[model samples]
Target: MSALPRPAHGPGSRYTARAATTRPRPARDGDVAALARRLTGRDLWLARMLHEHRVLTTHQIARLAYTSARSAQRRLRTLHEHAVLDSFRPLTASGSAPEHYTLGPVGAALLAAHAGLDPTALGWRPTTTGRIAYSPSLGHDLGVNELLTHLAARTHTASGSGLALWLSERSAARRWGDIIRPDAYAHWRDGDPLLPFFLEYDTGSQPPARVEAKLTGYAAFIAATGSRPALLLHTRTASRDQTLRRRLAAAARELDLQVATSSADFTTTDPWGPWWAPLEPTAHRTTLTGLAAHWPHLSPAAGLEPTDADTPLTLPVPPLPPDLGSGS
Candidate 1:
């Protein structure tokens, strides 16, 4: 059997790779070290928290850093000006102020390099747009994961170049009901059946039955929509529950959904963190197209033709949110 292509490890590798590949005068070691040390202890903590969480408002960062909101805001703004971060206007809940702040690709890489044990050996090169940024999760947000799964399903349907389809209530309609509100989503706008991949760094209270129902919903969405988006459910959970696996499979069967499992026994299918986070469009098409195409064959009676790739893998990553206020 052909070896599965490995996922991109993290931003640290990307930076090292870029330095090696670029013809320009390479960034000196002193320069790099200076850049790393330029951050204050508080800044370092704030930066790490933002990169790992992927998105956090100024308020969140202040709370995490145990600093005044003004301090957090200044630190974030400084990071942004230094090209260490980017800001975006996030979609807020009705009647709530919009949350703002997420690490840019470069900022994420710098944080990863600083925090990682062997950043030099990693092959992470930050692309202008196609680059993937990963953050660590706190491992307690089940509700977040549930929403992520739904986002993955949506992404699978939207894999074209430079196009991003988000599923939050502001734009994309809710699938099941109002109760299951998804946060956000994006993918290339190609016609090809995309993979439904979820990335979550947190968890919350979620019942097993709700989880099972979600699996069913995803399966049905894949089957009915005629899109074979591969699903990648990510979390930092310690153990993969057998009950969850069984429920997922039963739901797939009920929905006539053919899922791609790593093992024949329907055990754990994919890794959950930085290891699984680096799949680019080129890598995805080469590594995942065959498996993704299986949906059409498994449910032949359904007569759904697999969607075609609209463009090369490309999508918009929203800007980071702005700082809320000083925590102090």
Candidate 2:
């Protein structure tokens, strides 16, 4: 029998002990390629998702990618041990936090290859992740992800629906522009029309006016691209929702934008369902699917693909009209 290396017992033992025990075996390029080849399409998609979102908890990953936690646990462990994924458990006053996973070096390389981009351009580093694991904003970021991840999850079981695309704040900035990068950009198809929306999770910290001002950018972006995606705002409470709703209405009327407001304290079992209310105070709460009908400027679809090419676009002036005006 061989004696294992004596565990460190001094300061930083928490990280040191854990690191020593679960160190993943290094996988060569050939090994990584082979493993990557063997991965199901879903596995690759999950990897791409981690790259886009920065981090995801074990529970969130399960809900987003797998039918159950038991199954997710088994495959995630395999990916972790094979150096395809990395995770950390934050030290917390409540004992320990859930295992939050991100793309490993190998995983990042695979994703970069798939995207036809440089691995270094992905902006991922182990040290950065370590720092992020302890940041106070981690909880807020995860909560935003959790809300969107659940919507992605529902696509699997929900009828005639799909989670077509989800872009994080960073991705949104790169794909669109930072003039208005949402917490996430989600595009999906529900029944007849394709729905595209942006999500903003507010913790009641930023002043209401500051949040409302972002609508100006969104309006300008929509005018330029001919893409009209609703802006979804989820707040800390119904009271907060009401307060924002007033400002959202003013913005919508002033800038000719489309905004939906909601509270995190939901009464329904399904969080993705009908919790959203349009900026209008008289409007009834509606589901994500029902949101598009109320906004006349949105681009809708009868098929899987978006109908942007066929839809006429407009570049309206500052403070656009309720309708973009002069659309072909």
Candidate 3:
């Protein structure tokens, strides 16, 4: 007997596409007026700078907004609290302090929509008739973060039995500075503590030169652990870099690293977060050296493991609290 045909894709994929739209939907006017006002006002100024620059520190954002760093920080807090902005840490050259306050995915979407707004005296209007107007929602960020959290928690049991660890540019740089930072770091956390499987999520905007450098970085980092680790890469569009990806894979193997072209080779979940984060240790170590190694300057966390008490990760129904704004 032949094996049952695999589901086409996704949980609802087998259902007719027409059945998907049972509920009526309202076309969003958005807070177009409010959004426009913010865009033209001080509130959106930092967002605009972040959009133009891709990322910025609170100081940089403040300079663009002509506000004090503290004021800019407050605005940043508000934006993040409202899910209007997002932030991630990147290492300073010293790898001692991590820089915060950067445009997250949600912020990027809002800025994109604002930039695409129709220019008129009547102010902004939804372009739904001709081309749809898109407004990024906190829902979107909630969804993405949820997925990331889910993958981190579930990667070990995933079909691929991979480990997932969330790592930042700074940690990555400190560990593999000789190579390159791969934008985001994801590691499958199964066997060896030192060299768990890792991957990079490249939206395909990575330059060919940069791609080579990062490929080398992964190789070096994996080699340092003296273990062969999985190194997968996913790009939104692989058309342009087919050859580059092929080269990277070959290079990874030459260094005894397993390589995958896309996350698909590794998992079946669509929302199976492409991001991975390190796990919180089950037991806290008491020594100063251990504390320093584990959480750095950050004090001991309250709860150690994932549980209902901890925020629900990856489920987007009710938006999760902003990880940064909560100031935990």
Model number with the top TM-score: 2
* Model 3 lDDT per residue over 39-72, tens place: 3245454444333223444543443343255755
Over 4 Å off, model 2: 1-30, 114-117, 267-269, 300-328
lDDT of model 1 at position 239: 39
- Taking all chains together, the TM-score of candidate 2 against the true structure is 0.78
All candidates' TM-scores?
A: 0.33, 0.78, 0.34
Candidate 2, position 177, lDDT: 68
True-vs-predicted CA distance for residue 296, candidate 3, Å = 32
lDDT, candidate 3, equals: 0.38
Candidate 1 wrong stretches, greater than 4 Å: 1-76, 79-204, 219-230, 258-290, 293-328
Q: Where does the lowest 10-residue lDDT sum fall in candidate 2?
A: 312-321
Give me the candidate number with maximum lDDT. Answer: 2
